[model samples]
Target: MAFNSAPKQFGTILLGVAGLGAFVLNLPAAAGRVTLFIGQILQALAPPWYGRNFARQLVEIGFYSLPVVGMTAIFTGMVLALQSYTGFARFSAESAIPNVVVVSITRELGPVLAGLIVAGRVGSAMAAEIGTMRVTEQIDALWALSTNPFRYLVLPRVLAAILVLPLLVLVADIIGVTGGYFIATARLGFHPGTYIQNTWSFLEAQDVISGLVKAAVFGFIIALMGCYHGYKSRGGAAGVGTAATYAVVSASILILISNYLVTELFFAQ
Candidate 1:
């Protein structure tokens, strides 16, 4: 037993060292991926713009995404109102519900929720579509035809996400605030006029703008993660499925991380 314990301990130490080496090896690969993604964005801005593809992506990512975004926003706002009232009651600050709802929605919840929703829906769709093309050799076909896949496929989706997400966030802000107003007036016995006044007075242009900015960044992250995973996919159908899952998960994590960074940039004292 004593002799076996020493061997087992050495094996465990070797495994831990190997794991650390693997992590260190991955760092440069991750940097390469980020570099490639940036290059693609730059290429997207150059000539040979595909208006038709861009329009289609715009409709798909923005218009089709509205219903889900709206539902999430409205429900979030309503819940915030209820919770805010419940919490503030202890301090006799129930009158602050409208201010809290509007501020919270416009400043934080609206963009974050919308980004997460779109990332799950649109990011997965992008990954699936691109991964299918990769596994089917359609991407190679484009290269054979002297067409750049980055410009033709990646640009449209990325640009559409960056442009349309801000608009979606704007709509989310309005719907979320309105939902709070309704909850306040109809159920919470808040004076409609006073609630509106308080919301308007408390919310600044900075809050709305910061959230929209976050939305645009989140959109970029979503599209980038989706396209990157899908474009790099291998192993056929299973790889395609994995790409879709990675797109959603990576986009979501990036959204949360970027939300905090952007907030710090915009509001840090």
Candidate 2:
């Protein structure tokens, strides 16, 4: 019995290994397909640019998303300030908290949190809506009517995300730093004027620019994953659900990866 069980376990392990190898092999192809998809969308970028769809996408991804992003940023800033104070107080570096909070919020946390929030919220919605349309034959109907799905369906979403996310991140940076200021001054007994002065003085244009740039990249990734997965969804209802999940997960992972790369590009010595 043990021998038989051992063989079964080994077979299972071997199957898992094969699956992993297959994913590794297909990664390049998957990447190529995404590139091709973006290229086709660009090629389809002609007049009639679907102005209404772009407007709707802008409101959907940006306006509806603000409250959640704002809340998350404020709370994260509070936590970061409190946590930093713990370490900083020990080193007699409590005065640096304002500079640290401002820099960290504008340069890293603001863009990253905003991206993740949008990915989870707007990205999933795009995937599910498009996936449902795909399953319900709406996309086919559009194609039959001589409409290019990339232009009609995808282009607006991508463009709106690119335009709106930077704005969201900018708002988040301001709110996050404000939250930290409130915490440091009220809870930690910091001088309010000095804190504000340090925060304003220490923050640079490069830091804010880098974060906004990251937000744009993250927005593109989120929209791309959502639309791509939704477009490829085939198995009806269950496939739509899978596509939504894939959109959120992939957007989030790509956001983090791109965040690091952009940070390196901007700040690496």
Candidate 3:
């Protein structure tokens, strides 16, 4: 019995590793699928079947996530202001605090942090839910009923995430900047008008737009990973757990890597 169980356990581990490796190897294919799916969504004049599902996903992934993102942004902004002030004060450059906060939040921190948070919350949830459905053969049932799973299930989520994340990031940017403003004026002894003026003066249209673009891409990645992993889930309850974990981990890493690439593209001139 012990010998038989040992082989089974080893096989399981081997299979798990192989699955992970396959996931990594298939990144290009996943990217291709994403592009194709996006094209399908964009070309449809009015995909009535997708509308309700998309709205539901928008609420789930975006509206419900605002408080956490808002709190994260505010604290991040405040901490950034304090740290920037401390660093700049050593060089008598304290007046740069507002500008630093604005740039930091809009250019990097706001979208990345928001993406990470949503990955933990929304990504995991999506994976678990879809994984459970897959394991239960619901996805197969949808196919049997002549419904395209990609059209009905995956497209709505991908579209909703792509559309909603930018709005969330925009709100987060405003809240973060306000938090920095409050800290700069109230705790750091900077004049309120000076802080606001400096923040606004230093902020360009590109900084804001670039961050929103990153947010949209991050959202797409999060949803794609979740849907892909979950849709491919096998086994039973354990597989759902694994899918959720993989979704979060993969989405987070992808978001960070994509963020760096986008930053380089936008700022490397």
TM-score versus the correct structure, for each prediction:
0.94, 0.97, 0.85
Task: Please provide, for model 3 over 89-132, each residue's C-alpha lDDT reduced to its tens digit, 9 standing for 90 to 100.
Answer: 99999998988899999989999999999999999998899899
**Residue-by-residue lDDT tens digits, candidate 2, 1-269:** 99779989999999999999999999999999999998987987986589999999999999999999999999989988999999999989999999889889999999999999999999999999999999999999999998888999899999999999999999999999989999999999999999999998998999999999999999999999999999988899999999999999999999999999999999899
RMSD of 2: 1.2
Q: Whole-model lDDT for model 3 versus the true structure?
A: 0.90
Candidate 1 lands at a TM-score of 0.94
What shift in Å separates residue 79 of candidate 2 from its native position after superposition? 0.9
Best by TM-score: 2
Question: Local error of candidate 1 at 78, Å?
Answer: 0.4
**On a 0 to 1 TM-score scale, where does candidate 3 land against the true structure?**
0.85
State the C-alpha lDDT per candidate.
0.94, 0.94, 0.90
Q: Regarding lDDT, does 2 or 3 come out ahead?
A: 2
- Give the per-residue lDDT of model 1 (tens digit) for 32-111: 98788879678668888889999999999999999999999999999999999899999999988988998899889999
Ranking by lDDT: 2, 1, 3
